[model samples]
Target: MNRIQRVQKELERANADYLITGTTSNMYYLIGFSEEQMERPLLLFITRDDYFLLVPKLYEEQLKQFPLIVYRDGEDPYSKLNLKENSNVLIDDTTFSLFTIEILNRFKPGRIGRASRILGKLRQVKDDEELEKMEKGVKKAEQLILEFVSNIKENMTECQIERKLKSFLIEEAGNISFDPIVTSGPNSSMPHLRCSDKKVKRGEAIVIDYGIKHDGYSTDTTRVFSLGKPNDPLILEIVEIVKTANEEAEKHVREGMRAKEIDYFAREVITNKGYGDYFIHRTGHGIGIDVHEDPYISPDNDDVIEQNMVFTIEPGIYLPGKFGIRIEDEVVVKKGYGKTLNMLQKELYII
Candidate 1:
């Protein structure tokens, strides 16, 4: 009843006969319902004719808002499925584990295939309501980060700073989109390093990567800060290179560009500076209800750009045993432009 029309459209495009899923995000997008994940599987069945939700008796009260087919424990939930031989079934590979797969095998659908790509592509393009919420939530999120950066000082341990940062986000927003990344000195060289007890030294690169969950959307961005100008010129060099790569990619992205083109564009900038090997990870990823989704802007992807698709353009350079730098911004694809949602300075801040 919610975005069923979109699913219907997808059915037509995908040429599928039926759809089934148990993922929470897919449930939210397709039906405006988010089920609590449990050991007992919560199943959603969508056909050309109707929608059905099958869950254990315990969830019957919680699902009263929608039409559901409830079953008791130890009962054969498969008894309720309506399927025939040769019927194509689309399943969320991530959600439907082997346990769930075995249950579906009873239906004997002629074919079973991954349906995440179909849903992921559908989720890439945002409607006005989603865009409004994202913009407002991200603007407010930036202020909280500014507060963190302004108060940060030398000799603070990375874990302590992470705790304070998480505390601020938990106070302002109920959740984090992902675990925050806080690293300094040698640890900073690892792009995905989490917080540690290591003290943040002055005159070294410090990377802060984090995200916030607000208004049903997630905001992701990274900012690099320094207590004082590092004696190592390579750190500044890499930071400047990454900033330029971020800005260049954002400036040149458009509706017709291939997802890989953006990645290539950013990669070229880093490669020219001779730090290409040190720069790892994709240029960006589709972001919305889920922190990472479709339209991956990577060197290997072939997905084309379209207006209203929101994602990120993050570029970084990591020098092992030295330091690292990254500049990230959430961007929306427009007809002839890419609109970045974040307003934070990409330049390394000398805090």
Candidate 2:
């Protein structure tokens, strides 16, 4: 069956009368149209038998191929959509709350649910075209990261490195998924640390966590570096532990395994090394049209590991007031094992 057919089958199983999605990646997947979210909500309405798009009249000329329900400015967009009363409706999880509330009040459906229940499972398993595009995007990102790290100099501020990396991504990758996480020294302890003016110093860890966007897909990667050997010997120990954890987890990924099992494979390694408390956050997350998506590799997730599903295996250890170490790579689940898409070695890059 085709994509829409598959969604119809899911909707049947969910006992939902229809599915509504806003201008999000979910809409991009269902159809080829991609538009930014605005007050004028561009929505997709899908049923077991058919599907159509609802958009502001401004998009009428641009989207001429598919059936459209066009509404004028300052007009009630929902008024044209004829929804069945007392019927179960599924809405895309990422839809804006304003639109969601309007949907709830206007439709008065018997039940409202997240479309992710049907869409997430379908989106997790990628096809050949998607894997090929992601592989190329990930390889280019790996090259850019290597180049970016090679040029890192002592005393350069984190912001400078981020600026340089952004230039590299825009020049080669076309776009970026999110702002780069550039941190050094104690700042590295915070996994989500944003770029700052802190100067890069010798004997300190530097974490460059970044992602690139290509062909509407995303590539996420992280690598820890240092101007020289870190001042704390424990830094090297934690780096080794993280590296081992990433490798072990990737090595054991097999179809039919639970997503949380993958998390355990990595987390057990870190915890066994005696840094259980220091290792925060899940092992990884799925990457595709959006940087973060389904099949999240976390301690509590029980989603099955299916073939062609792509995700990340990232393991880290943080030592507050000292530094942190992390190694991340995107992996594609195959028949018997998971294969990493990254070409760069996970070894700590020492300048």
Candidate 1 TM-score, C-alpha based: 0.94
Against the reference, the lDDT scores of all candidates come to 0.83, 0.90
Model 2 Cα displacement at 255 (Å)?
1.2
Clashing pairs in 1: none
TM-score on alpha carbons, each prediction: 0.94, 0.96
Best by lDDT: 2
For candidate 2, give the lDDT of residue 253: 94
Model 1: residues with Cα > 4 Å off, grouped in runs: 96-99
lDDT of 2 by residue, 1-351 (tens): 888889999999888999888999898988877888888888888999999988889899999898999999988888898888888999999988888898889879899999999998899999999999999899888878877787899999999999998888888888998888999999999899888899999888889999999898999999988888887787787888999999999999999999999999999998887999989999999989889999999999998999999999998998888888889999999887899998787877887
- Cα distance off (Å), candidate 2, residue 297: 1.2
Residues 1-351, candidate 1: write the lDDT tens digits.
457767767776777777778846788778777755666768777776677888889889988877888889998777865567577778865574753566556767777787775788778899999989888878877988987787677778999899989988878888778888999988988988888899888888889989898877888989888888876887777888999999889998999889999999899999999989988899999999888888899999999899999999998888888888888899987767999999998888888
C-alpha lDDT (0 to 100) for residue 255 of candidate 2: 91
- Number of colliding residue pairs in each model: 0, 0
The pairs that clash in candidate 2 are none
Question: How many backbone overlaps does candidate 1 show?
Answer: 0
